[model samples]
Target chain A: MTPLAAPKALDSFFLEARCKILDLAAILDRINRGQGAGAVDNDPRLDKIRKALEVLHDQSGGRAERIQQIFSLDYDPGWDKPKPRY
Target chain B: MYYIDPHIHMISRVTDDYHRMAYAGCVAITEPAFWAGFDRGSVDGFRDYFRHLTEVEPKRAAQFNIRHYSWLCINAKEAENVELSRGVIQMIPEFLNKPNVLGIGEIGLNKNTKNEATVFQEHVDLAMKYHELILIHTPHLEDKYKGTRMIIDMLKQDRRLKPERVLIDHVEEHTVRHALDNGFWCAMTLYPTTKCTPQRAVDIIEMVGTDCIMANSAGDWGKSDPLAVPEMIQEMKRRGHADSVIRKVVYDNPLAFFRQCARWQEWPAETEVEKAKRKPAKAHA
Candidate 1:
């Protein structure tokens, strides 16, 4: 089966994507306006979000998976080992 | 546009949710046993939950012309209490004979802890002993990749469990290929937030094709939507996918998966005219 034609796919979703980008921008603006904003300037999660935004601009495809990985946990080799209960 | 939510938690949803889902063309659904927000104190708590899954929920769904089937297990959250989990696993066989019972599932890891793994293997033993199918719950955001890998390794370690007889739920963009590459059936949980959205699910379908895969709402005692599968159908249509391609993913793939169970019964039988109406599309990807 042929993949969704890139031009048609973009045309179908442009408005929805525009709305989501607006939502993300509004969310970040709200976060910056909050009282605790300065304290979170160096937060790693925010850094990751920034990195994910950078990924969105890349011309190479697969941005969805790359962005998902940006927010996902790094694989821990010893995750199955016994650990202290919190 | 008829679809099946291969994984959903109707026990946590209201009757109106079922009404809405039925109107959205949900013909059937399978509710996997999952955490009840908090850990229960004992095995009897789980027994009552199972009774609800196997008994009450099916009747509730039937009111809306929806066929409800369920998987049985002590979910990972409660499985941390190994002693209680064992008792629950031992008692699961009591409901195995119930007409709606499908297999053992939503049964894998949460934090990828050793105790969770221990109980998961025990559930596998119970499932294997009964010749039942298995369904797994991979962990959430931070732990998901590792947790899914751990669950796959554990299942692979047990030679008696065939990959086809098991399904790994909650697969995302990064982990979906791994689950499918290993030969196990997989599902994407479409949520309004946190998990895959309708658009992302459609993207995954485009990337992976439609074989041996399915999607679900996983609607439960949280922020979720019971009509997520239909939302995916709409997204597929908007992307210009053929109806046959959309139907195969939402309807045919789930039916093919569930039909593997020993007690599996045909549901909502389609008439010859209905079959003729849905022209077969090319079945690639």
Candidate 2:
């Protein structure tokens, strides 16, 4: 389905979006400011977060759903089968 | 514009939150037993928690004219302790007949472990044996999609559990269609962080038509808002959605889901005098 028009959508949600973006920036800054840069350098979750950030710049819609998928587990076809936790 | 928060943990919230919710036009709420912020060591802990849900919280909500209902379970986080989970599950039936008890839920997976799955099936077995409705909590963030997929699979395996009578909660844009397309009812939780915001929840509603789906605050002992559903109402209003459409997601849909429970009562059951007083008004209109 098509998204609501930008002006109408922005009128209601622009501030919320701005605040969230600021929060994300501050979070990244905090991570950068932390002493242990190497700790997160190879962290897969951080990699995923970076990939999700790249998703935000796409012109086409569905970014939200795509980013959610980026954070979500890939669909495991055999997920119902019980597996041991490491 | 009155609405029902189909899933919130009222036991974790202050009485003032209930008052604020009432003022914001929340007419009713359903609280599912969940992680108490820390795991309890014994089934007795859960037993006492159940009493608080079925007894204490309902009384608290009544003061503000908001109807309170609850579900019972040892949450998925605690379900890893299979022995304790079983003990809690066995004791759950004692509360099933209580006036405000809804069904077995917020019962799914946290880590989607083997032990968690075992506990989940046992809870499902208990629910099916009692013919009670089910409410499921899909795991959060990274584990959500897989956990939700597994939850739906497990439920489908049980021929006795009807899809429509179950609700898979905390579904986001990715998982919403899975729950709905599988014939189960689903709820999107509106959270200030880490879940759908009011704007995103409205976006989901825009993407997926309002049918067999609803939204809730899922307010609990976290950095969450009890008025999140009201904020969703505001968001929908700003987008120029019809009030009827908003009402369906927030009001009628939840009532329809809860009405399936045999124990669910008609709230504010009108007195005969009040019924008579209302009939004349209806006739004039």
Candidate 3:
């Protein structure tokens, strides 16, 4: 099978997305600093954002691979395995 | 240009979101019971949530001229607690007759566990007893395909469930056919991330053609867009899809599905100009 060429537009798209992420992180940092420790504590939204950022930071793949993984609907056969209870 | 968001978590959204949605040409929305970002400790929490869905959110949406409908269920995430799920399921009938209450929904699998499946079947049994419409939520990411398959199998096993009355939501390319081919309705959720984008949703429509298909924002407390259906409309227009085609996917299809509700009232089909000429009056609660 022929490998798909990367879309040229996505280069700028990802760059712009990264800038927005950084800008959001900066704003959140500023808010945290201004609010001090008490205000940040037990805020579920902040915790969720922090966890999402950690997941992004922990991703090992390149941007193209990550984008494909995020958007594609390809089924994983391994998902048939039994999952643990929440 | 008016549309119906067949599924959204409006309780998680603010009043301004409803105002913006009304301005964006949304006439109606149906919110399925979903995970409240965290699990509740007792059945009383779900009871209050149900009251909020049936009582409060409807009034809130009405302030902006948007009709609000809701489904009752112990969401799949919380279904893991089988005891609490059963209690919530038994209590669901108390609110099922509420004017704005739609049916049982957002009720499918989360982890594809045995307990989740058990609670799912019990919920199905209750819906069968009430003859209510069913709305399903397939799992996310890697679990979606298998989870959807499992849900389909379960639905098929229930002889009483008419496929057309059930809607399998969050269907993507690989999972869309499973829902449609079985004669059930399906929806694509347009989220900012981790779901169908507007372009992709339009592409799916082009591939599958618009039969029992629809799209929603699925906007919630998370990073999602409430204007996603409108975004899809713009994309479809840009791709030269006829206005009728866009309207079917966005407006007509959802109404068609929602019309099956026992309490659904038919609203008059009036043009924007016609609506404007009418005297302003308060909508019935």
> Which scores greater on TM-score, model 2 or model 3?
2
* Model 1: CA > 4 A from native: A77-86, B276-285
lDDT tens digits, residue span A1-86, model 3: 11112464365257867887889888787876784667676786566555555556764734332333343345443433332122
Model 3 chain A TM-score equals 0.46
Tell me the tens digit of each residue's lDDT in model 3 across B29-146: 9999999999998888999999999999999999999999999999899988889998999889999889888899989998778788888888888888898999999988766777
Clashing pairs in 2: none
Worst 10 residues of 2 chain B by lDDT: B274-283
Top-TM-score candidate index? 1
User: Candidates 1 and 3: which is better by TM-score?
Assistant: 1
lDDT of 3 at B108: 94
Across all candidates, what is each one's fraction of true contacts kept?
A: 0.44, 0.54, 0.04
Highest DockQ model number: 2
Per-residue lDDT for B184-270 in model 2, tens only? 999999987678888889889888889999999989889899999999999888788887789899998999999999987777665
TM-score against native, each model: 0.93, 0.90, 0.76
